[model samples]
Target: MSLPTPLTAEAEDSAGRRTDVLVTVLAFTGIAVALVQTLIIPIIPHLPEYLHASASDAAWALTATLLCGAVATPVMGRLGDMYGKRRMLLVGVAMLVVGSVICALSESLAPMIVGRALQGLAHGVIPLGVSILRDEVPAARLPVSTAVMLGSLGVGGALGLPGSAMIADAFDWHILFWTSAALGALALLLVMLFVPESKARPGGRVDIPGAVGMGISLICLLFVVSKGADWGWSSGTTLGVLAVALIVLPFWGWFELRTPQPMVDLRASAHPQILFTHLAGVAFGFSLFALNLVLPQVLQLPKITGYGLGESLATAGLAMAPQGMVMMAVAPLSARVTKTRGPKTTLMIGAVTVGVGYLLIMVLMSATWTLILASCVVAMGVGFGYAALPTLVMSSVPASQTAAANSLNTLMRSIGTTTSSALAGVLLAHMTIDFHGVELPSENGLRAVLALGVGAAALALAVASFIPRHRPDAAVTPADAIAEKVGLRPAADAD
Candidate 1:
């Protein structure tokens, strides 16, 4: 099979420097966005007191950002594909800057939450960046850049925790946002100076109705998931939002199918491999985030609890830092595995490893070393699984749909994490214990949440087994034919 000619002449003219520099800048842009998301986590405990806000109210700072991200990501991605990545990158960075400035200056929860929502717009960068890679970079260099770009999700979040903690320790929490804002401004400048406009899709139209519908559906779904535990899962408000999501989701799907230019290509997503990849993305994201949400709580719980370690926030962040290293170390290996054994085999191995990690945690929760080892194992699995997922989705779908398809995949992953957060909250709430004269698990409930993670990973593993392991170099089949008709390029020529 012939690869696409090394970047088109016009593309080459636009990309004068080494494509790697541009790719690195794009990758760093994505990493900066991710860092904004997790950087605040380490500051959460202190924010409530500093802002004179209730803990529950302050927590919305995180939830609001996630909710907005879940709603805006697909819309922004489609718009990026339609308009231009360079323009959108600048817009997203502007949003991040404005949001960070607002967050930095805010003395109350209300303004802070609004700033965070604006920052959510930045989440579009990665999907758009991934699509841009296909548009500009040589095929030979694309894979490694793609891997690093994607790997930033885990690495950024991991590094942000410690980095943010260090900042919080040295200065006030406001400094964190100020630092992020500065970084975002730098990214915006880099993008404007270095990144070229994408080759726009001719006659492409924004799917306004589809975008609105999907946006509303996601907003409702994420709202229920993010707020369910706080609002009472079975309460009228929670149930009402959930009911709206259930009704709107099918209609959104229907609308996407009927639209001339759907926000996301529903038909493309319906492909079996694509569908499975999405499902696996959801599970993997849920399980991976479970660790992020729970590990700190587990480590920081007062030692009065039978299972507590009582570490401080900085220490907890440090403890989890190693997992990021493991993830980075394993990512290239995962790419090689995909190249040799195909995405399915790599995915299956990753899922099984994740499940085994969770099982190890469940069975051996007596000491800190066990938790550290379990985290490393899970990170390795996540690195492998995360690497394979985009490869599978990108390979299965047409290149034309890469941004939308990957955005949708990213959306599913967010859905999984959002749902897991709610579920874990509920489980922990119900599983609190009274220990000696004090209440253990009352402040930070983790055991039940970790157990739920294990179950999710197991389910992910089971689903991974069903994904067909096609040879990476196999001849194009009927699916490839259909993809071509729908404007998708085959796997070998995908990037």
Candidate 2:
């Protein structure tokens, strides 16, 4: 046997290098998508004045993103499954870049809302990136890689808060979107260069009826949840919309079950493992967003209110920034736990950790350090929970259906977050302290919100406990072996 030349050795090294590039690119892509979620947070309060719109109209800047994201995630995921995951991912990123540029240049409500809605369409990027990772990365590297890639959601959102806050504070508000646009463009370029297209396309025509049914049902339901506070939760219009959702969802489920190549495989998804995982997602989402909503308000409100931290946006962001770091730092460890014990065990641990965080902070709401400590705890919980989800999902489904299955899981989280937003708004808005003739969230209200978070985490823990432990001969979708043979084990398979 002839020994290899140096040139040949370098060439072999490059092949190894490509894998790292692919994982890095996909992880950053996930982070960039998450950054878009929080890009406008610092400017949200002033949007009405900046855009010369009513507060309600200005609020659509946020709502548009949330609504569009909910609808687009599953749609894009299914499209990725049928066509190509990387192709859809690029398309999603392209929308974000374009949307950011539009928002960057806009000075009016209509354009800004349009831009934001466009941005929302790209929210599927995270899940698609996960799907892509599952398709391309080696099994030995998958768990840590999965943890890092999935952790981007928390890491990006956490960093975005402080990063955008400082940018908005220092420069024109447009800079926030411009920064997102630039980061998104970088992500796009990296993906094009590094990520390979998965050959596991589940080729078929999309189920249009099923898609439309799910869209309408989600839109109506989320609309009520997101808009009910502004629209008057008890108003006839709110009740009417809620009625529409209640009426439509059952029919939607029926259509999905009957459709060929359904957008969401209702029958497969009804498996206890997948079902309980998604159920936990809803509770996890609720617990996660409640902290974001309540913490910022608590940090920035006047200290005269007793519970308020009286911090500036920059300062509050600084205080809260540790959460993102904690999330990133914990990902590898979380992956380790999943590998050793099982994802179900990891998720249960995360749920308990998150519950403990909320419960601790409810009693320790006096100082900045305690808030930081509590936030980090919650972040750790998010890292563990988020990483476990993809594992749970990939295990339950086949490689060919990875994107669609994960997309559904992502959708469940959105539902939980949206519900959390509405419920928290009601709690904080109604429970108030009068300060200088203006009402602010009372200390009790903040504590109550924390209590609610504890409940949500506890709920997630309970649901996750019901997830069947992974067994040696556990079933996977028929496509798993093929995917593994093709060098991409779906979802960084459990150890």
Candidate 3:
């Protein structure tokens, strides 16, 4: 089978004798960063006791990381586009290393949460890796390399959960963070040794105000989504935060539109295809997290609940592990679909598959095997859908804006996931079923959460229908085509 190459030979050839090895190392480094993000999940169940935290407070271990990543990703992307990907990547790696080490050595949850926040900056690696493809690899290798790098976003987290579970079960929870620290160290070494400095934006100035505005807006928005359930969704705190987000987001948009070298070029995101991609990213990200968060609760419930399988943390992780592996396996095929039918078609297919997967889960709520099957379907759909998204975004935007553009895409996905987490929490809290007067499904409250996922996937399908399709051999490059649709000047020709 011939692989689609997106990079020119001159680009790949410039790396000399170590190009292949370097690419492999960088890919793994990207994977390690992904692993760190999720490696704590299996241990979440143990955190309350280990850290002497109340159940609600313990959730912050994950929430803090999510909040930090949501704020940092787009900012890092803009910095990478403005300054250098390698520089931002190295900074991210350093943060991850420090965070992991602190978490590994911490005696309390406060320090651990602090560490996780620092590690959140590492989420920038995935987009930076994708942007690197535009700068490095030979044109012939760009498609597959791009697919693999982006696919790692899902694959890394999926694989990390099971591995974390096994490690925690065999050793102790601290070992998981320590192992993550080691992975961070290795990633730093690989990045320093292999990834080349990008020439895309050698001397651009950082847009400090633009970055601060965007960051504050995102933090406010994500804070509402992440903590609204705990703070009372209608409480003054939550409503006030949402209002601030509403006020800041428009100003941030206006700021980006007016800045000569904005942190993120808002004009670039106005394209029909790009806009649809961001909207789809929200739905897709919601589906991914909904499944990840709910399935384990369902599987680990007491068997007396009638619907529960009573699995251990390790068993639950193993059950959901196939989704990640399937996603990895399907990503290359998704790339082919994009190459042949275009991104719009691929996205539609993914949306339909995702909806079908959720429908399957809803139908099989009474069976354990159904959970696994539904996960497989969802993973396959997400792999295809997720792979096509960055391709669509990158193809639509200029190479110069790859990092920032992709980061915005990533940020949208995070927003989706954050909203899903809050929404699912509220829905689960309200939808308790009285099972033999015992309320068996009330512990983790997941069935309602999965139902919300099904709804989100359906919305994704609706959004996918509006994404514009293009022919494979069309005269317009992906970025140009999107630029034209959005009425923006092409980046290559834009001053």
Cα-based TM-score, every candidate:
0.88, 0.93, 0.88
Give the winner by TM-score: 2
Off by over 4 Å in 1: 1-17, 435-438, 442-445, 474-495
Quick one: ranking by lDDT, best first? 2, 3, 1
lDDT per residue (tens digit) for residues 22-70 in model 3? 5576678778888987788777777889888898888888888887888
lDDT of 1 by residue, 1-495 (tens): 434344544444444355767877887787789899888887777779877899998888988889888877787777776777667778888999999999999998899999999999888788788777666665434455566777777777888888999998899889999999998998898888878777654438778888777877888888888888778878999999989989989998988888888888878777888888899999988988778877777788778775778888888888888887787678677767776778788888888888788778766666677788998898889888877777777677655666667777888888898888778777776768876666545433575677777788878778878776676755333333533544433345555
Tens digits of per-residue lDDT for model 2 on 4-52?
Answer: 5676567546645776787778889988998998888888889999999
What is residue 203's positional error in candidate 1, in angstroms?
4.3
The 0-to-1 C-alpha lDDT of every candidate, in the order given, reads 0.78, 0.86, 0.78
In model 2, the clashing pairs are none
| All models, RMSD in angstroms | 5.1, 3.7, 5.9
Q: Ten residues in a row with the worst lDDT in model 2?
A: 471-480
**Residue 238 C-alpha lDDT in model 1:** 95
Please give the range of 10 consecutive residues that has the lowest summed lDDT in model 1: 475-484
